[model samples]
Target: MKRINTLGAGCLARALAFSLAAGGLALPLSAQAADLPAAVAQDLYENGGVEHWLPKAEKGDIFAQYVLGHMYCNGKKVEKNYELGMRWYRKAADAGFAPSQLAVGTMYFQGQGVERDRDEALDWFTRAAEEGYARAQSNLAALYLGEKGVEPDYEKALHWYGKAAAQGHTVARYNLGMMYAHGLGLDEPDYVAAYGLLSPLVENGHRAADELMQSFLGEMDEEELVAARELSEELQAQDRMLVALDQRAANR
Candidate 1:
């Protein structure tokens, strides 16, 4: 599994959570935290499948517009068409949909539907991120990490990651754990802190987080290892509680 920059799963998790929460949809939190694909598929079906929404997208229903853009961008129930995807994304973004803004910015950065323009992407990402879009916050963290269109700024990366991580974005947690483990930003490596941040994801079978935790834990003393294990157990227990609460809520 790719250790670095494999934050797509984490990003998706936060985005869906924020979207669903904002829309007041009841999420069955028993759903695996790391299962982005299943969550997204369920979301799409619930929001009205591609057929019911695609025509609305053409007519500029902002949510439908964004979903249609994503569908074409990622070939969900439709042939991938970057140009059409960008067109739809831009329409929604221009109408002030934060998610669409981030999507358009990502396409620009990756040259998916437009020419690669890191600077332009950064500008758009900043706007969405500042408005508290978790995906934008995570992507902005990456830009800071990579020093795109600016100097390398570990502090900025940490700041943005903290924002996303607060919303339970796993990759942000992973990156913050790495920062703690590597003694970045003049802070000493703190395995206990890293473990606390990563344990939930690791318990959820996040491959990269698990690998990184093992490697990082190898450097800690036995006492630290014990502490880490205890922290992990607590996180797992918390996850179970969250699941139980979801079930209870559903029954109510």
Candidate 2:
């Protein structure tokens, strides 16, 4: 099946980088307590409430700036103008907005509105990742893993995956689980860790993730299966606790 790219050039592009880095395997996010990025909020304003936000986007507001960028980039509400999209995204990204940096970076990566430049893509991803943008971290990790714009390094891949994983990015968790399951990065195979990472996503209705997890586990014996199941139970409990904590945090 053709993978459904995430909305906008920013988040989905980051996921594309992760997909390439992890050799086109599944990657999951770990849940986190964080506010939406200004660019994302801008997206909502434009797409969610166009009448109210269109003028704001046209007036150089950072949130609206990005919404205008997406509008021009995809020609959704206005004339399709790569130059306009590029112009707006540059403004926001230059102001140190992480998502805008990523959005512009994706354009460079794909040569959508700008020249295709892997070097530029690296620059943008690095900027966003340094800001603790999980998608950018995953994307950077993929670049390292695939040697796309830099040297191939499994260790670097693990490092970035861990970064995104900590933020509850599904793709990062899924890739980390696969790495543990296959003994690709760490010293020994770690089915326990794999199950700990994956079971939550499978239960969360990620069909592709569920299939991948099942296939990976197919090699295990009955004993291993039982252990994995036990691990799943433990992870589920932990997930429940995490959810409770998240609710409390939000309430606070």
Clash counts per candidate, in order, are: 0, 12
Q: Quick one: how many clashes does candidate 2 have?
A: 12
lDDT, candidate 1, 1-252, per-residue tens: 112333344442332212212111112322211223576556655664477887887777886777777777767678879898788888888888777777777777767878998788778788777877766787677667653455557777767776777766666667766665554542355666667667787778987677667766656778877876775554445334334323422543
| Candidate lDDT (C-alpha), each | 0.63, 0.62
Model 2 segments more than 4 A misplaced: 1-60, 147-151, 216-252
What's the TM-score of every candidate structure? 0.62, 0.66
Cα error of candidate 2 at position 153, Å: 2.4
Question: Which regions of candidate 1 fall more than 4 Å away from where they truly are?
Answer: 1-55, 75-80, 147-151, 205-207, 216-252
**Can you give the lDDT of residue 230 in candidate 2?**
66
Steric clash pairs (candidate 1):
none
Candidate 2 TM-score, C-alpha based:
0.66
- For model 2, residues 32-113, the per-residue Cα lDDT tens digits are 1124656654446445434655677567677666656766776655677888788887887887877677777777777777
